[model samples]
Target: MSRTVFCRKYQKEMEGLDFPPMPGAKGQDIFENVSRQAWEEWQNQQTMLINEKHLSLMDPNNRKYLQAQMERFFNNEPFDKAEGYVPPEK
Candidate 1:
């Protein structure tokens, strides 16, 4: 998901926790960094799972599925087409 969306979702979850606000952090932006890190961790886990299972995530249908998810995360806007903006190859 987009950073903002992820942050909003995470912020909601975090509201149920007892974590204290970080010093000097913006209330609204509090979850952005943590959410981005979480997303990265999630991607790594997915990659590891695929590798361990010898899965072919490179299939055309798989590519489309991933693309759609990315688009959804991006608020349904077209994904970046600029060179070097491609999603993970796998």
Candidate 2:
């Protein structure tokens, strides 16, 4: 059976990630607190931001910006979105 966590974003128990998404304390915290669904959603948003804003992960500043945005996303606070982005119709 999969583990369940009280997801920080969804605020209810849900399926948890099999492993930490990244290294270090933040990853551990997210593994403990964030649900798989929330993590996946964040990844989608992160991709959109990177593609739309032309953010390069190799740049330290860009990485920092993404980190801040990720924190805001998880906290349910206001976060930046890709300007003029429209989701593709299904």
Candidate 3:
């Protein structure tokens, strides 16, 4: 049977991840509190942010910035947008 977690992002009980996403305390926290669906969504957003900002994971500062962005994204806090990216005219 699949596992369930109280997804912090969705604010509902949902299917949990099969394994810890990261390596340590934060990964355990996510495993205990975040849902698979929410994690996937964050992954997609992270990809876009990385590509848009031309972030190099090899750089320590870049990794730190991405980690901060990930936290803000999951917590429903405001986050940075790609430079020069404008919303489509509504």
Candidate 4:
């Protein structure tokens, strides 16, 4: 059976990630607290933000901005959305 966790974002028990998404304490915390679904959703949002805003990962400020957005996203706080973005029709 897969591991389960009290997902911080969903506020309920759910499937957990098999491994930390990154190294260090923060990654470990997320591994224990964040659900895999939440992480994947964040990845999609991050991509949209990066593309829409033309954010460069090489820039420390842009990275910081994404970090902050991630925190807010997990906390259920308001976060920046890519402007003028319309989801493709199925």
Compare the candidates by lDDT and give the number of the best one.
Answer: 2
TM-score computed on alpha carbons, candidate 1: 0.33
Give one digit per residue, the lDDT tens place, for model 4 in 1-90: 999989889999989999999899989989999998999999999999999999999999999999999999998999999999898999
Taking all chains together, each candidate's TM-score versus the true structure is: 0.33, 0.94, 0.87, 0.94
Q: Tell me the spans in candidate 4 whose CA falls farther than 4 Å from its real position.
A: none
lDDT of 1: 0.42
Lowest summed lDDT across 10 adjacent residues in model 1 is found at: 12-21
Task: Supply candidate 2's per-residue lDDT for 23.
Answer: 100
Which portions of model 1 show Cα errors greater than 4 Å? 1-9, 12-34, 64-90
Regions more than 4 Å wrong, model 2 = none
- Writing each residue's lDDT as its tens digit, candidate 1 over 1-90 gives 232333432443322212323345532233333355444544554455445445477687755655454434424344323233345777
Worst 10 residues of 2 by lDDT: 79-88
Clashing residue pairs for model 2: none
What does candidate 3's lDDT look like per residue over 1-90, in tens digits?
Answer: 999999998899999999999899999999999999989988977887899989999999999998898888779899876777666798
